[model samples]
Target chain A: MADEAGAAKERKILVAVDESEESMYALTWCLKNVSVSSNSKDTLILLYVMPPRTVYTALDGTGYLFSSDIMATMQKYSNDVADCVIEKSKRMCREQVQDVKVETIIEHGDPRDAICQVAEKLHVDMLVMGSHGYGLIKRAFLGSVSNHCAQNVKCPVLIVKRPKASSGSS
Target chain B: MADEAGAAKERKILVAVDESEESMYALTWCLKNVSVSSNSKDTLILLYVMPPRTVYTALDGTGYLFSSDIMATMQKYSNDVADCVIEKSKRMCREQVQDVKVETIIEHGDPRDAICQVAEKLHVDMLVMGSHGYGLIKRAFLGSVSNHCAQNVKCPVLIVKRPKASSGSS
Candidate 1:
């Protein structure tokens, strides 16, 4: 119980990734910034949400038709995406921060919902993500994943923008 | 110039939106929480960043072919996303607060980058977002966007978590 209590105080950092360049940049930044000391355990959690798949079976005016294999295929695809993100994260962690423990999670649901659920479950110290502006119409049409996460999570959220390589260029 | 200057100082609240349920919740929270006085100008800037098109373009042998059309399309999309976010923001502002001016901005770039840039340009007092935890593997893979922003940006960031719908759920 003492050991467990000690572990609870550890600083947990949660990161959201979509395999985008900005996401990659965010991952790299976390490794460099978070430090683990004897007193404080620093853990990093990487999360990827699989786009939810809903099936619509056709009815021949009488009853239900046949179910498709798309759901299975999508689950496999989601697992594959998680695997890829994990592999990359591991490699980067190994190269950047040697002492920190890294964890990976993959879920299927609304990206915002999944993220909030995970963050609460873990009770992390902070949540971090990368953002790119989405225009009004597209945002209305599609939705902003980061915005949802920011609004729902209780911890402090750090949003990293791609660093200007040069101030002169937009 | 006087009107523009007055507008700038009116305690602007910039809420980043991506049209997600969590973001909308944050928008609602912001509307309910932030106060506006007659002497103060409360402006809510709904910012959206369109993911860069170059990310999708095939690298091919040429290596990152930049197209003018794609840039234009991205800008248009960014504007649309901002517009959608602004509409919701305004509605909330109207319902929740008084004597407030709401504005929206859309940019084509990384979301994190766009947000920080706007915050600085507008000299906003604070930034509000949501936190979603990525699982262990992904956390290791992607790092944390909020952490990165906290380290880099000058303003204070507020990360909101979803409230438990019921006490039993907690």
Candidate 2:
């Protein structure tokens, strides 16, 4: 066995990441505000969900109609965005909590479903996310991803909102 | 000056309160999970927002058509619900954190607007609320109160989710 006697008691926290300033602020807030005492190891799971390319994953769409070039472009675009977000989150966390162990998850499909599914599958103790995001065209001002995950996930959710007037926070 | 030199540094956290188990669990969760070290005094503000009696407040409608008795009854009902919820939250927190200070505010309006307004007016450091509440049929399982506050409020919101299988947590 490893030298760590209390590895079994580690707390797993799932943090959602995206390119939005709010999302990066949430990552920084979690590192600053969340408890990571030395007595028990806690893992911060950074998750970036990419929307599935509709031409490829849509149930009724004809995959052959669009040609492979279009599909490849969309796929590559999502991959690049995912990579960018995860790396940025890593950089942010390093500036805040250098000793904390971090893990990254990049997945495809609906952001809401993907976050909830991963949190449940991993049995995380808590889910942290930005209060609002920039996606969804005609929905409420509140971002749907944070709202849906907060409701469905069986863990406490910390929705970090960047204070409207506070530049000193982040 | 008062004997306490650091009273100005106390953090004011406002927790939205209601009769739902989710809200009560949120209050309990705040006491157990949030920082409450002896060195820093954190005050918890218990807020209960009473939905406005639409018949009395609607601008275009014949608000005057309704008898004063009808308006009074609706007002009384909201008052009763607000009172009951505030009392219940006080009782809940007493059993958890005896030293924590609790304050209750009841206002009549849309729950979404009222919660955000009070949080700003009071200048709370953090807004704690239950993730899912009993409201809105079309929203993805998350309630509108927690969702809207998380989006509009300037303070960080902690949306407590009662873990589905954890009965012993409280």
Candidate 3:
């Protein structure tokens, strides 16, 4: 077919995942709805971005309430969350598309910037993410990460918003 | 093998096209980067939205600048542009993906609202569009059509941004 020549090149699709159900829904949606070519070498890279750890100073805004061990425990919990999210997302891909090549990536920073940076560094063909679906007031106070990456990422960005009716089912 | 069951249902992808080079580039990018499945019956709907015809009323904002003949001429020009854009886009799909089914839709209204409404009405699986890549000032001054659709559309929205480096090559 005419498209065979175009399918020779490998295409990488980066999907940003975290603890949110929205992100997982995005991964499922992509598996069901977006893949460049079945004959082509297509890879689904599951990306998990961890928020940067906050330092505890003597006069920190939180009153330096946490001791050294407490801070370490918090860091451990964050790592656990990231691991769980990645494992779940990988399992989903395996269940949905058996032959799809899958890879995992973990980054640290603000999600908005880290997502864009990793997508550029990896030179992905497209970036898939889920919108938190925040309302007007909540979105205003806590800016939407998907929106930020959509504006900044150099590659194509796919923002998947779970339908309101299906939100409860998921 | 596992995906065959999922591929039985038909998937519709809506790609919004216009006169802008960015939009054309987006169509090309989508053809190369995003398609649900090769075996599944997927339809690509090339939608060209005409900005709603302006009302030329006496004592209007333009100080009653247009006569009846002028208004009719302007309307004809708008229709011509829509036809030309759709033809160009159809040719592109034929060149790239010959076997894939393609459809065309011409809508009249503000693109932001019209795009969202059309995607919902068609029950498309995904909505593909090109990012105008407006700067902060320009985007603020004239709200982005892609951004609005991404926020409002029920289906996954793919906003393809033509890379700055390759913008000139195309």
Number of the top candidate by TM-score? 3
- DockQ of each candidate's interface versus the true one? 0.10, 0.24, 0.45
Could you tell me how far off, in angstroms, the CA of residue B60 lies in candidate 3 after the best superposition? Answer: 6.4
Predicted candidate 2 versus true structure: per-residue lDDT over A16-75, tens digit per residue = 888777788777766755643331367889999876666365633665455677767777
Candidate 2 runs further than 4 Å off? A1-10, A36-40, A53-77, A134-143, A164-170, B1-10, B36-39, B51-84, B132-143, B164-170
| Residue B74 Cα positional deviation in candidate 3, in Å, after optimal superposition | 1.3
Every prediction's TM-score for the first chain?
A: 0.72, 0.79, 0.83
Lowest-sum lDDT 10-residue window in model 2 chain A: A1-10
lDDT of 3 by residue, A104-151 (tens): 998876677788898999988889998883234545765998888888
lDDT at residue B112 of model 2 (Cα atoms): 77
Task: Report the C-alpha lDDT of model 3 over B16-55, residue by residue, as the tens digit.
Answer: 9988777887788777666533644778999988856654
Decide which is better by lDDT, 1 or 2: 2
Clashes of each: 58, 0, 0
TM-score of B-chain for each predicted structure, in order = 0.67, 0.76, 0.82
Which structure is stronger by DockQ: 1 or 3? 3
lDDT of 1 by residue, B22-110 (tens): 56655654554333333236667777655665554543325456465665676576567667766776777686666677777767666
